[model samples]
Target: MGPDDPDRPVKLAHAALHRAGEPLAFGGGVLLAPGTVLTCAHVVNQVLDRPDFAQERPGALDLLAVSFPATGRRRLRAALAAWLPARRADGSPAAEGDVEWSGDLALLRLLDDPGPAALPVGTGPCHAGRPAYAWFGSGAPSSIAAVLVQGVTERWIVLDSTGSAQPVVGGYSGSPLWDRAQRRVVGLVVSRSGLRAFAVPAADLRELFEEAGEAVPGPLGVEDGAHGPMDPVARQLLGPLRSVLTTPEALADLAGRFLAELEAEPEPGPEPATGPGDDRAGVDVGANDARADDAAAIDAGAIDAGADGSGADAGFPASAERLVRLATARPHGAPTLLALLAGAARTQEQQSWIATTALRVCPEQFLTAAEHRELLTLLADGTVPDPRRCAAEALPLGPDLEQAHWPEAVAELERYRPRYGRFPQLLRTVEFAAAAAGPGTARGLGAWSEAVAKRLGLAEILLEHRAQARESAERARERGPQRGAPAPVVQVQLWRATGTEHFSYALHAADARGRPLHRSVRDTPVPRSRLLAELGALLEEVTGQVEPGAVPVVEWFVTGEELDLAVDQWVYRPDELFPGVLGQDFLCVMRSPELRRAAFRPEHRYRWQVLRSGRLALVDRQDPVVQQRGAPVPVCGVALCCPAEEVPRLRAIALAVGVPGVLWLRPADHAIPPDRVRELVHGAAPYQLPRLVYEARLTESPDGLHRNLALVWDSPDGHPETLGLGDPRD
Candidate 1:
């Protein structure tokens, strides 16, 4: 075979030696230096052992012959060569006494030169999954089969052969698997399964050979005809058949037939290459056409090499070596410099550098919309480290773009976003945008809408408000409440009553005569003293009822001495006293003629119950069970009363019912204005009650208790009222 046969296969074999009576043993080797041989330390040891040293048979321990099919049936003796055991890849002895089995390799030095046709050494590393061939055989017509290295091991290799060929049999050892393209021996087929086999990498074998003072041969091309053996059947069929078919007339006929076939085949219509520009002048049309005709079509990919071939394209802004040098510069400015350079261009080099720098600096800048989109495309198409790094670096840049840009960014982010929603930055960015721009602006509202989006997720709140406003305006136009429309008047009845429905008073006011004022009802039960004191103080001011000698007194009912007494107080009617009342006030009076006429029932109990099983019961003071009625009543709602011993339990009950606060009513010495009372009871709750009471406390009084009443109110609104019930002079 010539030195370039397309079908030529390489062989990787092992050499073994059997001591006289001992069983046969073999060690791994490769045909690196052509006719020369390279084997493991154990192989060399077997070759050196003598028959007398280990047993009984004669000639069994004789020097074995090494041969290749290309050299015919001639066998070479092992004794003619030197053997070195402990040598480094540089052909020097390794560190003294460092005969470690991990580097279990040895080299053979042939006494005579093996001439040319030697197997060459390979440089660089091999990538995973690249197709490879292996061989295992000896002499002419030796057993040879094609195999691929499956895995590399510390001592042995795992391999796989296409056909059912045994990787290891008798007499097939220490053969090299030559890489046809590089004309170098890349691996040594050592172990074999029924069809699968493994070869030790040639790079590793070469190091072992060089370490033992042996010269590595130049690569033997595939046409070197160095394959070991073939099946007799295949040989006869292929050999004679091939020779008979090679006649000039036959060749001409075959060529003509092939040409006719090519002509007969349908041709592909030309396709317009869609791109920004036409840069196909330098492209090899023949190669492209061939590729187009092949089963796989040609695809334009990201260009790494420059138009002018200088070196293998680094596909980066700077050479990786240069970048490394810069990264290791004395001033340590490479990261910043690289970042600046990345911003200047959008080349592969710049992208690479930016990605690299981002790993150390701010990754967010490089992971921009354009770069991220581009990187995603590259990654999807199976680009390596660069794509991997691009993806990794893109992670830190939060999804903070506008709503329109979010879909694309999120699509890119989806590749790496955590399944459990742990990406806080992504969530935050989406949320912030939604909150600032409103939910309408936030597109793609889904379960994964950012936390901010969820927070502002009130659907079309503003739109609904606007629609309502429009509807209101339309209604106003249709049914206008004007001055001429029946004077637009309303009559409201205001009522007052003494303790728990003993007597009652009522006044009716019309909008026209009484000047209808807007009102809000807030149910707040206050101490009766508080009401009396407040009303008395107000009467004192409005009526000028100041007396010189008599002690000022303010009663629930102002009659006789109550009118003469100068009680500097203010009184507030129930409706005027509280705002935001959720229920009607329970009123009782004994003196009012209206109450007497109505036959007011003092036995009737009025109370309010909350949804959560809490109750507030009202009882008249004049009733027989006044104290007991006011005792711890199993109430079903929030209660507001003066600050008392029972308040803590009520507060607890209110809290249990989720009523935010309670109003605690207390007796008052002086009247508090209706406005101030409303302010106190409007949203009164327990905790806020003390604060209100403190503010209302008389600061001038050293002994705090004598000042007045301190009312504690607890409600969601937290309003509280306090009135002074002590002697104003003291």
Candidate 2:
């Protein structure tokens, strides 16, 4: 899934069989609906007295339970609701010695919600080469970094383990193999042979649902295309990214043109401006009056002028002809064309077409080093909304050669917002794009296998780093501290008995100084159930020792063989955390005690602060309806209507204060209640943050833009005056 995949929340933790002291993981199940699960029937079948026959009859319900990771490892009882037995075509159950059996799928309904959201039943095809994600229940549930479907039969889809780190082991049976491209669970991994795994195709799953008289829901767009699988050459050249390209031949031709141009001479005239909208006025005004020949020539000029204008004399018609043929044959040259277009589009029209075309494709590889830097630059400075949005979307999904960090990505995105402020479809894409760094970290961790060695030496590295930081701070203090000593900063460390697992907190007495003393250590093992109680105790202990004005700062660290092994360092203010108050407004806004508790964990908070904080707070996301593609999702912007005389104060707040999604709404009347202003400012949805602050200016503004946070005066009529700010027509 590109991002915001609904299926992500519903991956069921596989069922386990508890023996003496060890829990034997036997099968996996996927959440099909609220309180309902889909798995393999054989997984939950109990062997009869003869040992040859396995059935769901008698005491089988008591033996099966479903586990949910989101529910703090809670195991809930489940009962078989439906099943298609593993049997021969003759309808006889498979004999004792018969190993290969068809129709192995089963569905179970949970006694209660297992705390995981349900996964919608998919209607898409399980195609070969599509990216798949399989979570297995071995010891603890672990997700495979990469799983690719190798083949698709009528009833089953075959999975190739070459890309994944873990094989489809025993416990993986009944696990859903999710196709990333289609954004659905296409199959259930039912059996495996060495590195190969097989899953019941989505068609069978849909058929099963239908036979049981259940409607497999929509939002699953189309079933797999009827075209037979692409041959090896096609797979090698374009892979799955070909699905997005509208004119693949054109892309290949573009790439070929680049190659041909490289071999030709450069007739460099005054460099043509190739950025978005550079030719907008020229192209849009009276172009209809121009002959068809002139229009074609202009189109030709777009390609030949060549992004920076150096390749203005290169072959154009021949290149265009070649592009069509190549796209028809195979998108083998897609990557080359993408790389070329990243920097070489010569005209506004060309750039727009390329950008729009790119939005449909999701490349598997990262951008080239030059392309990566250029994309970042475009995001930071590109003016036209479409091209800028394309660059924003491209950055995250594309590879990061520099191993670019999320903070840098976030900053660039923030800069891009105002210039091209409103693309709701792109917002979700950007949110996922920003998170590429975190997954990149996880990918890096997979390659490193010296877990024990790294574990042994990590403490020393951490302490040494901390010591050096303190020394740097002490030196800074001697030179002249930026501010006076901050309120008492206490470092609290939480640990488990393993001497290996631990969590630490550096509670700052004050947040205003933006500094912490980093002295002392305390330890505790935080299971979420008792987390609030423990934090309460820890807070009391630290509060008594710290200065009165000190603001507590806490950070968590998990090491050794923890579930999430990544050494993530995320900080949270004590009051801002769950069961506390960051500010009165925040407390009031996020009022649910249960919601606060669920969201208070280190992993969740770290993810939000690092990955998901665009305009929309995805925290309490409800089930989304079918998203209207390309539509601008609304984000409420603050519209302050005030008397013209008091405009200066409003202007000051708008210009001096920078908050992510806020805009000054200028009403023609320029008059509204003060309380209403506050409500508008705080209550608008995330989408309405002003990209460009517009104001009726007094002095010629500093930045060359006409927009400003204006000081508007009230009309004498005591009616709301109209400003073009909220006008539907820009």
Candidate 3:
């Protein structure tokens, strides 16, 4: 699976469609021979925004930008050399609906050196039971499906999936069908029917392939819901803002103010309230002929997509009209802007138009522009804000929501990106970080939330006081505690990797001594599907149990090779989610019983004692193919990554030496340089590795540092478990 393995030409061969010079992909394609690519013609039409059977072919100058996702982002220009529009056997084009097409093939030839080699060049009948592989076209074949050619037609082949992790969705067209039994590709995957894949046979490819080239694929590198349909609430808030900023000046002012507040140096002092009506409010709402004809006349920095540092200078006038044109013109402008400006405002406006607008709009959450700017800078600059102290700790909450809101906000801000722009949820988190960042950092943010709470009669203001009072009273009541009596509350925990890795887990909703605490379990074995369904259903119950302002932490009890199983990467409630992962919300930790018991050993004792602060050693495995016991002496928790065959033994050696924490990649092929991961982890502590790896996995690239990263984190549970612990049941 390494990049040097010429037999597996994954990266430099698989290609995706993009506008010339852009890195974004529109659809998938594969290299046939040097300089040539084959894909479904519909993908080209889709990218070009043309009708499926548009008779016009691409001109010679109309080259498409292509990139091999598995490989580096080395873009190549490709021209359409051959085209066969979606047509019926009669050679007539298919209808404009979502019907299948038998002849929707296309070939694109690179202008320069095609780096990848041609694929297998033969065509024939396929066996019905033989297993094959296919993938989504946008990126590398990280998640592939095993397909079987169930039925064949003169031009179409019906391929059914045996089983696969990812579904064969809309983006999977034009991928290669690698028939495993024949050890060569038999056809091209042209379309899918639910989980079932429909392919075009190789006979047509040989006749159409001509002399060509190769390439490879990887991640689409697109975030989930990056193209949001806009939530009902978001759209509601957006409506008012759109209506007000009709003229070019108002839009320009808002956009300019947004940019200015984003980079403004905070001034120390109180926020003086301004009047509702300004003398300049009556300034012409209509666009005068004084406006510049060309858009380049405006400051480039204000609208730069790269999030550059340069900015607009003073004397640049504002305009809602010009702003509307820019927003209407650009497709990628997030906030998913839809320009609709209003006519003259007969009645004058409010104190601090931005602040007044923030209060009136976004009734769901009082997220403001100032708060967003402060937070965006913090996230962009990579500052992890800590919970504040004092009354400001109590916004003017540093305004005091760090304790109230920062935790949730900090959680959201992890590995923040500027492209998120002004998402409501994103703003909340940014304000959360600001509140906890100390002093007057979060004054404006706190003021906004409080204003909203007061307006809505919300009791959120007294939440912190109530929690603190409860804690003090409890401590006062239990003055002479000797391991205070446990509450009747249930101790719910989900145990993963206790059995076979995939789709298996053990549940414990009991008290300290393994006695039942939560709801009663169905003692009898019902249907297997029902049992798994119950496990999924219980997630809601577990989520409900979490205290307000607190997160749900899923502690996994795993041991032996089970430690290497990737459980964090699992998708939770995917059907309803915006493609969220289990680890994103849950503070997942793998706790091993073996490591807990090993505390009797001095080396184990030493390891945990020092690793309490998350520090650890990264043990490099010198052995190329075999397991070695050459771990460093007296080290605390350590990373001992090795080849897959050597992993089990290396894990055993660490466990034997009493190491309480460990990390490694599993089923890992060195397609990405193994040594490169060290650079990502250079200054990170052992405790930070899990989050680091989780973020890396989100890249969805085969060449990502998170190649099924697994960890053995047997940290202390903040309670004494060592007093007397032993296995009771077999």
Q: Estimate every model's Cα lDDT from 0 to 1.
A: 0.32, 0.38, 0.46
User: How do the residues 1-730 of candidate 2 rate in per-residue lDDT, one tens digit apiece?
Assistant: 3236444543433343221233555666766555566777677663112232354433456655566543345567776666666765445677666545667766676786655343344333454545777776542445553577766543467777876777777767776676665555666787777787788865456555566454444311122211223322222223222332324344445444644433322232232344564422122223332222222322334334334443321333222333322332322233334445535545453443343333222232122223333334433422212322233233222221221343344334423321121222222333223222234432332222122112212323333323332343344346453322222222222334444333332222222222332233323434433443444455555556543433333322222122122111111234445434211111001001111122122222222221112233211111121111111332112243454344434433321222122223233333433343344345333322221121122124344112223211110111111211121222
lDDT of 1 by residue, 147-228 (tens): 5545444434555656534445533444555444443455554434456555555435444445545554543212211122
Off by over 4 Å in 1: 2-4, 7-31, 34-36, 49-65, 75-101, 116-131, 139-142, 153-157, 179-183, 192-196, 206-730
Ranking by TM-score: 2, 3, 1
Score candidate 2 by lDDT.
Answer: 0.38
TM-scores vs. true structure, each candidate: 0.26, 0.29, 0.28
Task: Give per-residue CA lDDT, model 3, range 111-134, as digits (tens).
Answer: 755443423122222434456777
- Flag the better candidate by lDDT, 1 or 3: 3
Candidate 3 weakest lDDT stretch, 10 residues: 218-227
**Top-TM-score candidate index:** 2
**What would the TM-score be for candidate 2 when compared with the true structure?**
0.29
Q: After superposition, how far is residue 436 of candidate 2 from its true place, in Å?
A: 62
Model 1: lDDT to the true structure: 0.32
In model 3, the Cα lDDT at residue 222 comes to 12
